[model samples]
Target chain A: MCTTCGCGDGDTRIEGQGAEGWHRHADGTLHHHAQPGAHAHGATDPRRLRIEQDLLAANDAHAARNRARFAHDGIFALNLVSSPGSGKTTLLCRTIQALRGLLPVSVIEGDQQTRRDAERIRAAGAGALQVNTGKGCHLDAHMVSHAIAQLDPAPGSLLLIENVGNLVCPAAFDLGEAHKVVVLSITEGEDKPLKYPDMFAAADVMVLNKIDLAPHLSFDEAACIGYARRVNPQIRVLRTSATTGAGIDAWVDWLAAGARAAARSATQRAGPRGVVA
Target chain B: MHELSLAQSVIEIIENAAARDAFARVRKVWLEVGLLSCVEPDAMRASFEAVSRDTRAEGAVLELVAVPGRGRCPSCGTLSALAAREDACPSCGGYGLRPVAGTGLRVRELEVE
Candidate 1:
């Protein structure tokens, strides 16, 4: 279990899945037989069941469905992940304001136990739905699937998913977003990318938020990008201050480009199967 | 922790396998865990125990086979061993080490009756 969202399972293959390299004693204990199928009572003896499966198979399947649905609907979804107090919501609200109906923007807010972020997003003038994770640290694909069914976001629209403000757990779960944008406030440590490598490693864009206060703080902007590049060389870096609306234009332009690309790509195929129309 | 949920998922897989393979009892589970992946073996063990209570997988031994991370250097196209995500390529000493392997969590085999 992770201190933040949750610990995730990785993918691995175990050898000797056949009727060999395993055994069970009449009494349950750490015991093993050196040979395969040594017991004469073939039906009664414990058997080695070959079950090679991924722990996240279920979640990955759900994410694949979500990804297909988003592509089919032409929805450009972005999953925002960051540590607490990175101003993710403020930046999202301001981004909503900046778009100003350029594209229908819908937000799905993930919080452990509050509707505050959803309310803030709704107040900023966008269709917002709150998915409180309760005791859970981050949102999962099943939750997003439900939210998508309810939101029914229009085609060629923007779906901004504000993942729970926790860096560690959200990295493991894929919500079928087109991109994962990680927000790190300038007030935070510049070594965040190295300290939380998993989050930085998973993100596509590293947004340096709260840049308005950089003049007063000792934040090293270049070093942060450098660290981010070390983990993910292809990650695009962006700086913004959601309060003053500074640098929001470039952010919007990025979003517009993605939205346009999504629309163009959506028209090229009939559905997830890639059937040309 | 999502590990708790992941542990639950393991049980679900085992139970599904039980139905598919017609097994009633499980003695041990062989799990291949990626060394670079986010999963912690100790934590997963505890969580698996906590979630497997009263289930067909109760008291099942989980043997973890560690898979080390492997990276490929982009500049020289040389494959190198990776201990961590921030590790520099040993062959080229370059920062652009693309992850080629590791980071997996899967149930490989099970000992059952």
Candidate 2:
């Protein structure tokens, strides 16, 4: 019985049977009081593994709902994931410049405390919503919904969710994004994807930003691309230099195309399916 | 590490579950740590121990199950379990590595009594 969701209270299904005798108390309540030196049940059991998968199924159901909501809103949302100081905000600034007059764009910036990224996005002439996670590491769907309510984007808008600078936890929580854009800089080694494959696998597009500084660093472009491709062959890789204005057009165009596709699908889905005539 | 926060989230989830299920204490937690998720099992274990104290999950045993990183080698048409972060195909040393699974973390199970 979950106090928050009201879905918890049920029969007792202990992981291992006979580890210790489960007694019915005076109030007819069942409890698995583990006793010392209890090895009555086998240590390795298959039922335990199935129970774990069931727990994950519940979370994935919530994630699927979020995905559908984003799709129905006709909004092209991208989750910007990366390590801190990997040029995520700088690339976003440049991307806003490239797509400002072309599309109806908005941003949801996640940080620990300061609203610096939100301020920067606002200064760049875009609607910005800031979510201060406090001690939270990743942004869940509930936080994203709150951020969306704050942004108040009109129908058919492009929402860029700049997730907290983390390559691990953010991948677990879906932000209802059509794409996950992982921004990696050349200063970071090419082995990043290999080390953080979950982030790379979740990302639909990989932006190898700060390419202008590639000449000064020992980071190999070929190795980076290879490593990213190894993790996600379907991921669209783009090299951009915010300071140098390189590959900005491609990024903007990709975003525009995604927004258009989302809008078209949303319209098509909403039109039929037994309309209320 | 991000696993610290993840462990915290797992604790919160279990606590909530316990509160609703009329369970006073959490006996154990079964966690699934994906190989490609970048969540160090050691870090998660340490964080769990540090945060679970004085809570519903206090002194609860953490059982970790490692999910193998299974990927598809595009060039070789081989699906294999990746022991580490090596993207190269073990048999053919191919470059085309496509992750088929093991890219996320989950709090799989909880035992409460």
Best by lDDT: 1
Best by TM-score: 1
Give one digit per residue, the lDDT tens place, for model 1 in B18-80.
Answer: 878888778778777666677656677788889899998886766655666688887788898
Please give, for residues B42-110, the per-residue lDDT of candidate 2 as tens digits: 667788888898898887767655555677788888888664444678778875566676655667776
State in Å the error of residue B68, model 1.
Answer: 0.7
What is the clash tally of candidate 2?
5
Question: lDDT per residue, candidate 2, A1-277, as tens digits?
Answer: 2122122355343223211223332343333222322213335432222233332344455566767777887888888999999988888888888887788889899998899999999998889999999977877777787677677776677888999998877887776677789999889998898777778878888998889997799998898888887767777898888889898888888989999888888887788787642
lDDT of 1 by residue, A231-255 (tens): 8888999889998988999999999
TM-score of decoy 2: 0.78
- Model 1, residue A140: distance off in Å is 1.4
How far is A88's C-alpha from truth in model 1 (Å)? 0.5
When only chain A is evaluated, what TM-score does every model earn? 0.81, 0.78
Q: Residue B79 in candidate 2 has what lDDT?
A: 88
